[model samples]
Target: MKTWKVLWRVMMVLCVCVFTVNIVSYPQPEVTEVLSKYGSRSEEVRQIQTKLKQWGYYFGSVDGIYGTQTQDAVIKFQKKNGLRVDGIAGPETLAAIGISSSSGSSGSTGASTSDVNLLARTISAEARGEPYSGQVAVGAVILNRVEHPSFPDTIAGVIYQPGAFSCLNDGQFDQPVAESAYRAARDALNGVDPSGGAIYYYNPVTATNEWIRSRPIINTIGQHVFCM
Candidate 1:
């Protein structure tokens, strides 16, 4: 009976270890966070791809590129939303289409409204005119500012400070935001960063600050140039 008891205890310990591993391996929402920050695949890209698949926008695979089928779907969404029918995902187009991002974010993290809104403003100013991948990168810029020693430690401070963003200075950021902008912000709030740890971005042709110009260039998309 002593030998039997030892075998049972060993089996219980093994079972406990297996259960712990399963818990660790379970696919958490945080998986999206990992993909958001480091991954090049964008949330908007995923959203458009999913929407196109659902709404019969495209019969092809949901690749993240804004090619023909995706463009057609965007036009369809724009037509549905009473926007100018441009087969492109511009700010107006993104604004017109209602996005249904899983509110799985704030509910999961209990994030405050201000945090969410601040992120949304940044998204609106930076990536509203750009593509979905660019939106995530803009959100990453705010998060990077929080961690950087030279800038303010919060999103509101970084955004609201004088001369930080043209939109913030001219009250453009205060305008009604697109649903895509809101979703992008929520994605950022939920820890999706796309800037690849970029600390600064500027329009290269007009950049005057010598210090700003000295940083290594990372990527250029739309009108902004991102840097470390």
Candidate 2:
């Protein structure tokens, strides 16, 4: 009987140890990992930081690192926008923050057909052979300039303003718009400004305009330098 009791106690201890080991081996999953998380670093995260700061949800620097502060800001934005509040910049969260994943109805400009066609043609002419983001950035610069006090308040006015775009004076702006240019125009209208609110962009290699070179640069994309 003494031997049996001792053996039973040992078996119980072994069972408890095995159970603890299993518990530790498999932990719970995180909230979500679609867009970004704590410790993530990328350009997308940097853009997210900038947008959140612009909208007053974040006060941290616009660094590409996604740390505790970025996560906190994301949570606040999600809460304010009635998202899942998982503290992750997923597709829904990003769209609500003025960044859309696909071409949807998030931040549409609601302009007429004439305006879109003109912008599309301008984008195709100015940003031809550039990356898709660069194309969108070009379109965004026009939109940004339209809102700036220093530039014309209308799309046509900005595009037609003397000495604003080389393509306009070089007859390139009259070229037929490409399919990609149309998509880029729609994206820009939907508030997808990859230039981060830049009002101008110029190619450093081919541009001879010294006056444009003197503007404060905001960011670079493909072969263009976006400026404020």
Local distance difference test, each candidate: 0.65, 0.80
Model 2 residue runs over 4 Å out of place are: 1-108
Candidate 2's residue-wise lDDT over 100-200, tens digit each? 45422323465644456667888999999999999999999999988899985667567656667778668786666689998999899889999999998
Best by lDDT: 2
Top TM-score prediction, candidate number: 2
lDDT of 1 by residue, 30-139 (tens): 54222211123566766656655654556667666666667776667555434567675544333223233333224465544545655776678666678776777788
* Model 2 poorest 10 in a row by lDDT: 99-108
Candidate 1's error at 68, in angstroms? 58
- Residue pairs with colliding backbones in model 1 are none
lDDT of 1 at 195: 62
TM-score of 1: 0.49
